[model samples]
Target: MVVKRRFRQVFTSLKEHSRVSYAKIATIGGFCDLDLIVVKATSPDDLPLPDRYVHELLKIFSVSASSFRAFSLSFTRRFGKTHCWRVALKCLVLLHRLLRSLPDDSPFRSEILWTRSNGLLSLYPCHFLDDSSSASEDYTMFIRSYARLLDEVLDCLSIESKEAEEDEVLESLPDKMKEVGRMLEVLPQLQSIIDRVMDCRPTGASTRSFLVQSATKHIIRDSFICYTTFRKEIVMILDNLFQIPYRSSIAAFGIYKKAALQANQLSEFYDWCKFAGLCGSYEYPFIDRIPQIQVYALENFLNGMWQLTESSSSPASLLTSTMESPLSSTEDDSDKQLVIWEKVEENAFPRKLVKDEEEEPLLQWDVVDNGNWEDLLEASIGPCKASRNNLFYHSNGYGNNMGEYGQGEEANGWQMQLYNPYASNPFYQPQT
Candidate 1:
């Protein structure tokens, strides 16, 4: 068996050397040799492919996005056709390294993660079997499981890359529910990847290789990334539980159940890592179970909020606000909804219909006599102080004019009051 394995290695090395030599020749003739990239990527040597090849791949990607598909096809084809375990593992490592090297904002990451043609970026199409020896078969199984985990990692990176691109827009118009939905989408993928990492560990009493040890390092690194990201997203979801919206009581309950399950699973997974003596286990933070108090509080909050929505006259319209409100306005009447302020007060912060009328209020306030500066300051800040007394002060407080406007008549445009940050005031006040 030893003789046979040596002979196979010799033959593989010769074949690889021939390909590299031909690729060098192709390069000298001013030709782009993609096969060279694939050969280097799937090299049977235990060590990682050198930095030059990675740079070459990035250069190709820089030319055009479409050119990247060609590289993907070649890399996937090599992985699919190879019978050697070392070559297959090398393919996985090479792909993993490429993903790590790419920037989070790169468009290529999504393409690599989701490309479905010819099973690119997916291992489901692989059917590897090495029956020459038990050790070889063990390596094959490890490769398969590791490949599965890499698929999940790619999935996570893709989601994050897309999110980074849309970050500005999402921040400008923040949506807590939408953000939570995305976190929900990614959290499970991290869990699955960690599970696969566990499965990729060496089988009992199986003789390991330098290649296998190298693979172990990659697995450990990936597990760390997955574990840290998993914990962070879970904690964020829990911390912001009150802000995230739910469609119904069941949805909120579902999140609570998921959080609890993930907490338990994390504890178990960490314990298993400790038992297995996996590197970096000691560095992991202590797992804290989600407190039931939080769950109960969330339950109460959801109950009150949903109850208010149900009792509203236009429950369907509650999702939106009227055009008069600063909330988004839709031109379609069917999509429009009554804002709370409109229901409570008809003339609160009324917007001037004409631009000409809008300028009149500011002009009236600016032309106040410089002689009565104390009266002017009093007039500006006094009515606004009334706003701090009540949480929901919506009445138009301008029944008496302070400047040029006639007495006993309300101001024509919006009403604004001055605030002294130095003075004591309620923690929250209306802004308009």
Candidate 2:
């Protein structure tokens, strides 16, 4: 009972501090302080910690988990949206570190806890963008920090000895492979977040907008490049595994095959984005847009392994086509042209109209005599026919001719003032 009360007090203190002090929430002094208390209590009794007491401590950590969850959800809410962005990101960073700090023997060392914690962290950008108050600087910083965390995690999981014998390396490969797969699952989410952040505008006008925009573009481009690098490293590790005797290499080959397939898919998606113009020139380049040569070579090597294992024509046919086709041929020039044309059409009219009006007319074709055209059209057509969807028209069809000229004693004298060809049309309109 005393232990329960003590844990309650500790939970309350940690919860209170998590809200205000970013530094304190991140340190061992925060929740880990409570962990020490629980550990010490068991020592004084000279007995193994009661399962009930340990459960109570888990419950306390659960509260910290809930706090992080609440912080993430609060980002989209109207109240404190601006202030919550930094707080929530900080909490996630701290929680990620805290989870990593748990002893190997701790109950929380399981995959479930890590997944729950990392899943919340992965959703940071989805909520971050939902908040209207988030600044570009916040997004830039969040992305950089998230990337750093991933790098650290990967660095920890990476195998050091490149020349180690297959048996020696295979012992550690399973755990390392699982970690890589888990981290790979998070890449798509990170890419999606970076894409959305790039699409977001700064909340208000500021001199930093250009810099923020540039920084975000670079971050996204660099992140994708980093993902490709990590994939290459994984493939190289798999290749080392394949160098062993055929009997031992079979299981490793299976993992390698799957990784190769996924790498192909990721590369294709990146290419689609680049060709579709979703990516900008500020970061994405025309030549060597996606680093897929390594992916292609890895894929071919896996396909050869599959041919050997299954005695199948499928892998042979796939390899033949892959070798025959140029990477650019995958996305047809006609489709690329169509996509470019569609974008041009969408931005062509109003933007062109605005620019033309600002500059002095240089050619006969450049000058548009809207006033005279309207006068001629009005003389030809009497009054605009009323339609149900027309805002100016009424159900009884009486207000179809309503305009500045139709309002007063001038109504009878006004000759249904110059019928505006653009008025009835929704697409084109001359700016007032």
Top lDDT prediction, candidate number: 1
CA lDDT scores, all candidates in order: 0.55, 0.35
List all candidate RMSDs to the true structure.
14.3, 26.9
Off by over 4 Å in 2: 1-83, 99-432
User: Tens digit of lDDT per residue, candidate 2, span 181-244?
Assistant: 3443444344444344333323343213443333334434654655555545544444333333
lDDT of 1: 0.55
lDDT of 1 at 367: 29
CA lDDT of 256 in candidate 2? 43
